[model samples]
Target: MRFVETRWDGYGFFLDPSAYLAELPRLRGVLPPGAWAFVSEPGHYDIPRADRCVKDLELAGIHPATDKSGRLVLEFAPNRFKHESGLRISYTGVRHLSIDYEHSIDWMAVDTVLLDEILPDEDGGCVHEIALTDARITVRCRDLEAVWGGGC
Candidate 1:
């Protein structure tokens, strides 16, 4: 991953689709251990509960680049327990998107993030999952660009 510094945040970096997929294993390990409802057994959550970490990140917001066309972006901000860093994921050619939330998304602590290829090496189409404390987001898109936004 290339670390590119930004003005608002101390640092920021971009990752193309391939790089994002390659980093999934490492990103899964970076997230905190989800609730017992998630773990305690294999595939209890239906898909797969990703691994664990120390600090938890929270959902900050979701933005659309335009009204027409399938383009979207989701942002996860650090809880500040330890640091001030976050992640922003941009999706293009979004064939599908589902955001199921019991309540609002503001400050909702994220449990895990999963991005699986819809079909192995097929035009970058993927199913991106954002598992949060009170919500579950799934997006199927042709391409994904991720940005790591560091320290406030």
Candidate 2:
């Protein structure tokens, strides 16, 4: 439900649990729903869906750090990810546009991680986001690109 600023149009935020929800409505105006064609009562689906791809990849669920913090972040791995859990979408005739991933990492593998210097200048932390457009698609990933910090 939270949003982070990023370098994409219309969509760009690390960890958009509802990104798919928005995408379905946006695309519905342009094309027919996917689920309706294959099966009846196609309650949910989405083409070029973001939520389906980013639901989980195991980002600490919480970073517990901020820009003011100066302490190093602890390294830890996630037990599961959204991809493994499966994403739910809304649509009838949905077709995959493309799922491009910039990075896929487990920053927890490295100790002494810092946020201010480690995370991206915008929307940094262990958070990541996926972007989908009618003409182009992008997935903003950074496995080891960012670091988290905890105030001492």
Candidate 3:
């Protein structure tokens, strides 16, 4: 799929999915959990399809806490290898959510991060793929916003 560059006010540029995938190998050992698996596998990666797979694996359902009108936020803090600021992703009108953390909260440290938006489904809800250090967060919502320079 072809991805175009879009600008977000508080956030910087969005990475071109194709370009990011190509650069993955060179950035090995520093990739976030989901991305590590993508790079390790052969053949092309399908973002939307992967999102579906994750949702299926978790048997995801709309949480009672989910506000079809509420927002879901996820933050990734920079680690020693990456000196840049942190990242925060917010999804609006969240309809579905899932999180998998491979590390304890106290030891959390983010490395290379990747985010991809899935095609809208019949219900008009969208899904985002968040590949983070030792964690994988997936959400289906109506809108998404991302910002840098968070985490202390």
Candidate 4:
């Protein structure tokens, strides 16, 4: 799917890890164990979806952005999981992945580096920018939307 690194101002959605918020129901934690993130645009290389080279990234940490425009950057922790075609697309730009979208376990892609392959050029920030845009992200951890506030 897609990694939605958004940019917002004046009372953004995710800031504090609060359970009362409309988003982050899971307090304290950054994201869930399994999250599906990516974009609709193809990668820069000829990386097929059924390649064994794909490496899934984890939402490791969340912190402020170095850019003046961007206020934060959520680090994809570090892990890898394989994926297949059983995912259910709930809506546009959204996918429900029962399996973690970490790597091309079932040879889903040429290389799991697909997320890094496609991204809007940016120095990194916390303004609610589409970190991973136009792609379908499977986020099992609801906290992702709360911590990052991803949208289609």
Candidate that scores best on TM-score: 1
Each model's TM-score? 0.50, 0.21, 0.44, 0.20
Which stretches of candidate 3 lie above 4 Å from their native place?
1-69, 100-117, 132-135
Question: Backbone collision count in every prediction?
Answer: 0, 15, 0, 51
Worst 10 residues of 2 by lDDT: 112-121
Against the correct fold, how does model 3 do in TM-score?
A: 0.44
lDDT values of the candidates?
0.45, 0.24, 0.44, 0.25
Model 4 lDDT at residue 129 = 23
Model 1 alpha-carbon drift over 4 Å, by segment: 1-55, 102-124, 150-152
Error of 1 at 120 (Å): 5.5
* Candidate 2 C-alpha lDDT tens digits along 98-147: 33443323333422111010112133212222332211131222222222
TM-score of 1: 0.50
- Clash-forming residue pairs, model 1: none
After superposing candidate 4 on the true structure, give the runs of residues whose Cα lies further than 4 Å from its correct spot: 1-54, 65-69, 80-152
Please identify which of the two predictions, 1 or 3, would achieve the higher TM-score against the true structure. Answer: 1
Model 4 agreement with the true structure over 77-106: per-residue lDDT tens digits: 222344221111122112122223322234
Highest lDDT against the true fold, candidate: 1
- Give the alpha carbon lDDT tens digit for every residue of 41-134 in model 3: 4422443343211111211122233444576666555433433444445567777777766543344232334444344435555556654434
RMSD list, candidates in order: 14.5, 17.7, 14.7, 17.9
